[model samples]
Target chain A: MEFEYPIEGGDFTRAGMASSQVKKVLKQLNIAPAIIKRIAVAMYEAEVNVVAHAFKGTMLVNIMPDKVFIKFIDEGPGIHDIDLAMQEGFSTATESVRQMGFGAGMGLPNIKKNVDELQISSVVNKGTTVELTTYIS
Target chain B: MKLTEVVNKLELEVICGEDLLENTVTGGYCSDLLSDVMGNAQEGQVWLTIQVHNNIIAVASLKELSAILLVKGLKPGKETIETAIQQGIPILRTNETAFEIAGRLYNLIRQS
Candidate 1:
């Protein structure tokens, strides 16, 4: 199965909508609770990253019998240093974004810990794309 | 332990989701950072935090948390309470800080 959800930048109010939808779909598919929890955490962090940093983004999810795949493509000020951004305590979020209890510099690292495979690519002035895959087994 | 029991024991105010007072409380997690809770809090756990925002509800729901316990006399916004009601996860409040409440909650659960 496949699904797509739009992500709005700087929209803290709706940051987790896509992840919520994915959780529901996973539940309907009888995915194990443990796996679903991991996916929910990873997806939510990625979604919030878009809302906190990107101009706009889209989440593409594909569910298969043995694995689930997700791609988050965001158009905005792309990350200049992927390695630095991946560090647990590195973030370039604005003050307003951090005030809401987000932008703790843990989002991307948390996503990495939960997902089986993660790929991140970005261009200086264009955008960033994150691909995450998790084996369902 | 039932959420109602915790409410009564801790003297927590039920801000919303009164209908879910019967939910079970398996454990407690105290954290102000959203990602920490998202990455560490387990299902059925009661989250204790000073942050009062609608996203708290989102994290609680996504993690299948039993309820949210607002610490240090913090009150949630109108939208936050409404989301808690809609999601059926109780929003609870307390005058104590996370450290105080977490300790008490730990003893309560441990004794049970």
Candidate 2:
């Protein structure tokens, strides 16, 4: 099954809606609790990233028998240095965003830990695309 | 133990999802950082934090958490309560800080 969810940038209030919906679908499919938890965390972090950065983004989820694939595509001001962004304590979040307990620079690291495979590619001033895949088993 | 039991024992105020007070509490996690909670918190656990944004509700729901306990007398945003009600996860409040509440919750769960 495949699903697509739109993410509104700078919309902190509705940040994790996409992840929540995907979680519900996973639950209905009877996905194992451990697997669901990993995917949920990855998806939520990706969703938050888009909302915190990007002009807007789209989350595409492909659920197969053996694995789940997710893609987060967003517009503009892409990462200048992917390595730095992947670090545990590096973030470009504004004061207010950090104050909300988000933008702690743990988003990408957490995603990487939970997902089996992660690919992040970005063009400075252009856009970013993050692809994540996790085995269901 | 039921959520109501925790509420009564800890003197936590039920901010929303009153019907869900019957939900069972399997464990508890105390953290204010969204990523920490998202990365470490488990399902059916009661999350203790002072973060009062709507995303807290979103995280709790996504993680299938049983409930959220806001400490240090922190009040949740309007959207937070709304999301909690929508997600069927109770949003609980208390005057205690995260450390105090977490310790009490640990003892309560252990005793139970």
Candidate 3:
């Protein structure tokens, strides 16, 4: 099955909606609780990243019998250096975002730690795309 | 430990989910960072933090946390309370700082 969710930037209140929904779906599918938890963490960090940095974004989730694939596409100031951004302590989030206990420079790295596969692509002035895949049986 | 017993011992004011306080408490995790708790907190653990927002509810729920203990008497907005009520996750409050409360909670859990 497939699903898509729109994320609005600077809207902290509505963040995590996609992750929550995906978690619910995974639970209903009787996926292992541990796998569901990992997906929740990865998807939530990605969702919050969109709210913290992007102008707007979309989360696309495709769940198969043996695996789940998710993508986050955000339109905003893209990462100039994907390598640097992958570092645990690198973040360009604003002060306001930091004050809310977010933007601790752990978002991407945290997402990477949880997912079995992570691919990040970005253009300097346009946007970014994060692809995540995890297998569950 | 039943969540109700923790509330009584800690003198936590119930902000919501009063009827659901019978949740089992296995442990506790303290962090103000959302991702940290999301990455590390175990299910049935109570979360201790000063952050208050609707997203806190999301994190607590996603982690299958037992309850949220808001230190410094910091209260979430009305919508947050409503969501917690709906989710059956209790929101408890105290006027102590995180440092003060964590110590007490650690001792409580240890003794249990």
Best by lDDT: 1
DockQ ranking from best to worst? 2, 1, 3
Better of 1 and 2 by lDDT: 1
TM-score of each prediction: 0.98, 0.96, 0.97
- List each model's interface RMSD: 0.7, 0.7, 0.9
CA-lDDT, candidates in order: 0.93, 0.92, 0.90
By summed lDDT, the worst window of 10 consecutive residues in model 1 chain B runs over B80-89
Considering the two chains of model 3, state its CAPRI-style docking category. Answer: medium
Query: What does the lDDT read for residue A39 in candidate 3?
Result: 90
Per-residue lDDT of A21-106 in model 3, one digit per residue for the tens? 88999999999998988999999999999999899999999999889999999999999999998898788988878777788888
In candidate 1 chain A, what residue range of length 10 has the lowest lDDT sum?
A94-103
CAPRI class of candidate 1: high
Q: Report RMSD for candidate 3.
A: 1.1
Interface RMSD (Cα, Å) for model 3 = 0.9
Worst 10 residues of 2 chain A by lDDT: A31-40
Tens digits of per-residue lDDT, candidate 1, A1-137, equal 99999999988888897899899999999999899999999999999999999999999999999999999999999999999999998999998888888989999999999999999999977999999999998
What is the lDDT, from 0 to 100, of the residue B29 in candidate 2? 94
Clashing pairs in 3: none
Per-residue lDDT tens digits for candidate 3, residues B1-112, read 8999899998999999889889999988999888788888999999999888888988898899999999998988998998788767899999998889888878888899
